[model samples]
Target: MLCPRCSLSETRVIETRTSEGGRVVRRRRECPSCGYRFTTYEKVEERGILWVVKKDGRRESFDRQKLLRGLMRACEKLPVPLDVLEEAASRIEALLRERESGEVLSLEVGDLAMEELRRINKVAYVRFASVYREFTDLSNFAAEIARLIEEREDKHDNH
Candidate 1:
């Protein structure tokens, strides 16, 4: 690894450890030339491994941060925690990676996120669904809320 301070090509790893539930590997390094110390994180890149096919027929590389940001926005000012959203993002990424086609629709991603949010928080779910499903009018929101209520009722009956 190159040293950021002096741009030296040679660096030695001083320490190594796993983090974020073993999803990331962190390495502490020091530059021999400049004695600069820095930390580097290594994680498996899902980039180019999966593609998101947008509604307008454009294909873009799937980004986990982008997905998490959307979820955060939906849960903004709500009681939902960041860890919940992070886990949901990770689950969404994992499910997408399991696909054999190497491609998934943007709508599919949104639906997956909504599923996670719905289980975590109903308000957040509706907030996400409103934008994901493009709720332009009050009726759209009402219809979604109605469906959500009906699902709850069905589950209650089964229980």
Candidate 2:
């Protein structure tokens, strides 16, 4: 690696560690000539799965920010922390990467989001599900609420 201070092309790695669940490698390096020390991170660049297939049959590249934005909109004014949202996004990305086919349907992504949101906050989950599932009428929203209530009741009964 080139030394940032002196523009020297020689450097030696002093330390290395894995981060982000081993998805990245953090390396500490020192310039052999100038003695400048710096750190760098290395990550395997895997081409992510193809874009989500919209219900209307449109395809686009997967965008992390867009996904985060959707979740953020749903989580607006909720007590959910930014770290929780980040962790949720990371989990979703990891899950998508695990698919052997290297492709996932839009509905699948939406389901994953809903699952995470449900664990984080019920209101946020409903907000996201309503828009993502394209609820057409009030009955759809009511049905979702009813389902959530039933789920909670079932959990309470089990406990």
Candidate 3:
């Protein structure tokens, strides 16, 4: 690593630690030529997953931001914290990485988001599902709400 103060090319690592739950490595380095110290982070670059096959048959690379944005929108006005949203995103990414095919269908992504949202908040879950499933009318929205209620009831019954 180059020294920030003197622009020297040589540096010695002084400390190292894992960050982001081991998703990245944080390193502290001192420049050999100028004694300047700086921090650097190293993250493993995952190979690109195959493009998502859209409902219209269009192919596009998987985008984490898109997933995050949808979650943010659904979570608006909900009591869920930002950390919860971030953890949900991290979990989704991990699931994608675990897939043997390295390619995820758009439908699969939507399902994953809905599953996470359901655990976060019911209102948020319905909001996301309505748009994601393209609800056409009030009946469709009502049906989703009823389904959620039934699922909750079933869970309670099981316990």
Predicted structure with the largest TM-score when compared to the true one = 1
**lDDT of each residue in 65-104, candidate 3, tens digit only:** 7888899999998898876786687678778878888677
- Candidate 2 lDDT over 1-159, as tens digits, reads 899999999899999988657776889999989899999978777675556777678886677678888899999998998768866887897888787876678788889999999999999999999898889999999999999999999999999
| Model 2, C-alpha of 132: deviation from truth (Å) | 1.2
Better of 2 and 3 by TM-score: 3
Estimate TM-scores for all models: 0.74, 0.71, 0.73
Q: Measured by C-alpha RMSD in angstroms, how accurate is candidate 1?
A: 3.9
Number of the top lDDT candidate = 1
**Residue clash pairs of candidate 1:** none
TM-score of 3: 0.73
**In model 1, which regions exceed 4 Å deviation?**
1-21, 25-42
Q: Candidate 1: worst 10 consecutive residues by lDDT?
A: 41-50
For model 3, what is the error of residue 9's alpha carbon versus the real structure, in angstroms, after optimal superposition?
Answer: 12
Which lDDT values do the candidates have, in the order given? 0.90, 0.86, 0.86
Candidate 3 worst ten-residue window by lDDT: 44-53
All predictions: root-mean-square deviation over Cα? 3.9, 4.6, 4.5
